[model samples]
Target: MTARVGVVTFPGSLDDRDAVRAVRIAGAEPVPLWHADADLKGVDAVVLPGGFSYGDYLRCGAIARFAPVMGELVPAARSGALPVLGICNGFQVLCESHLLPGALTRNRSLHFINREQRLRVESAGTAWTGRYTAGEEITVVLKSGEGRYTADAATLDELERSGRVVVRYTGGAPNGSDRDIAGIANEHGNVVGLMPHPEHAVEALTGPSEDGLGFFTSVLAHLAGTVPAGADRSG
Candidate 1:
């Protein structure tokens, strides 16, 4: 059976459709999930696309973390039964929900940033990165205001030591993120949060390159148990 990937649509979400399209292009079935719904509908994976959920009130993703859908998503993802990818504002949500560590703060420049970005794959063993090779470089769209990923020094060190730092910005830090970190994964590598909008880079005609397609395909491969040899599938 084709893998079913859920693309969640929270209020004010702007990239949910792009996420659904990316999933479909990657050969998986896209299931639309609403923030108010508590059920996951048995999807193999989930994507929280970028957007200003709840008008970015209180704080970016702070309010959306309490969404009814997250009530179900949090536990399942914690158990490593569900692979979740959070992009941009979605990344903020994951951090706010405590599904992933660290918080996304305002850009150091204190301005919204939108541009094509270069990133290096730091760990390709995760469920969402299996299609990539460690050290490979790719270009994807980066657009956000609160995009700086910050964590306590100890937490940041631990993330690096555990090989959970999924990707790092190449060239220079666009948002002044510590250590040029652009994305990270949970200890199990099942949950990944990226500051860039990978869904927007899945198609060459629209994106900087087709580099972002690997993320969706990687999850599908994880579900099918057909990831490349030597892949870490513990998640």
Candidate 2:
């Protein structure tokens, strides 16, 4: 059976369709989930696509984190029962929900940064990154005003020690994120949140490169048991 990946659509989400398309492209069935709906429709995995949820008014994802859909998602994700990937604004939501550590603050320049970004895979063991090799580089589109990832020094050290820092910005930090961190995963490796829009880079014709397809394919591979779970740690 094909793995069904649900893409959640918040009120202001802009990349929900693209995320669904990426899931289909990766040979998984794409299920559309709504922020207000408490049901997941029995999806095997879920993706929170990028967009300015709640107009980014009180903070990027503060409001969306409390949406009805998250009520079910948070518990499943934290318990390692469900795999979840959060992209761009969705990353903010994960942070706001405390599913992932650290918070996304505004870019040091305090301007919207939009461009193709190069990132190095720091961990390939997570449910969303199993297809990538450690140290492999990939390019994905990143567009956000509050994209800088920040956390207390102790928390950063703990994440690094636990091998949860999944990806890092290559060459330089585009948004002044500490240690050039671009992505991270939860302790059980079922949850991942990244600041770049991998769904936007899945198609060659529409995106800068097709490198981002691995993120989707990785999840499928994990579900099939083709990839080992919670073992491959970053060096």
Candidate 3:
């Protein structure tokens, strides 16, 4: 069977279609999920695309944390039974839902940033990032206002020690994120959150580079048990 990857669409989701297109381009069936629906439709994986969910009310992803779709996604991802990838605003939602540690704060400059951002893959073991080798650099589109990632000192230390830091800004910290962190994964490597818009980088004709296709392809590789070279599949 073709792997089915669900792309959740929140009320204000701006990149859901792009994410769905990426999934199809990666050779997986893209399933559309709604914020108001509790059922997952039995997808092998899920992608939360970027956008200002709930109008960024009370904080970027604060309100979207309570969406009905999250009710199912939260527990499945927490149990390591599902692979979940959160991008941009979706990354903020995962933090708000506490699936991934830390919070995304406003950029130090307090300005909305939009550009081609360079990042280095720190951990290739996560389900969402297995296609890339560790330390490999890639460029992707990054656009966000509250993309600075912050966590307590202890949590930062643990994330580093456990190899949960999946990616980091390589060109320079555009958002003043702590430790130049751009993305992270959970201890089990089933859930990941990234501040860049990988979905927007999948097509060579329309994006800065096709570097982001790895994220979508990596998930398909994960579902097939054919995880790429650098992946740690122990979990």
Best prediction by lDDT: 2
In model 3, where is the ten-residue run with the lowest total lDDT? 226-235
lDDT of 2 by residue, 1-235 (tens): 9999999999999999999999999999999999999999899999999998888879999999999999999999999879999999999999999999999999999989999999999999899999999999999998988999999999999999988999999988889999999999999999999999889888889999999999999999999998755877663
Give the candidates in order of lDDT, highest first: 2, 3, 1
Number of clashing pairs per prediction, in order:
0, 0, 0
The total number of steric clashes, by the backbone 3 Å criterion, in model 1 comes to 0
In model 2, where is the ten-residue run with the lowest total lDDT? 226-235
Error of 2 at 9 (Å): 0.4
lDDT of 1 by residue, 1-235 (tens): 9999999999999999999999999999999999999999999899999999999999999999999999999998887778999999889999999999999999999989999999999888888999998899999999999999999999999998888899899987789998899999987788999999889999878889999999999998888887632255322
Global fold similarity of model 3 (TM-score): 0.96
lDDT of 3 by residue, 1-235 (tens): 8999999999899999999999999999999999999989999999999998888989999999999999999999998879999999999999999999999999999999999999999988989888888888999998999999999999999999888999899967899999999999887888999999889988889999999999999988888888732246322
Q: Which residue segments of model 2 deviate by more than 4 Å?
A: none
- The global C-alpha lDDT for each of the candidates, from Candidate 1 onward, is 0.91, 0.93, 0.91
Choose the strongest candidate by TM-score. 2
How well does candidate 1 match the true structure in TM-score terms?
0.96
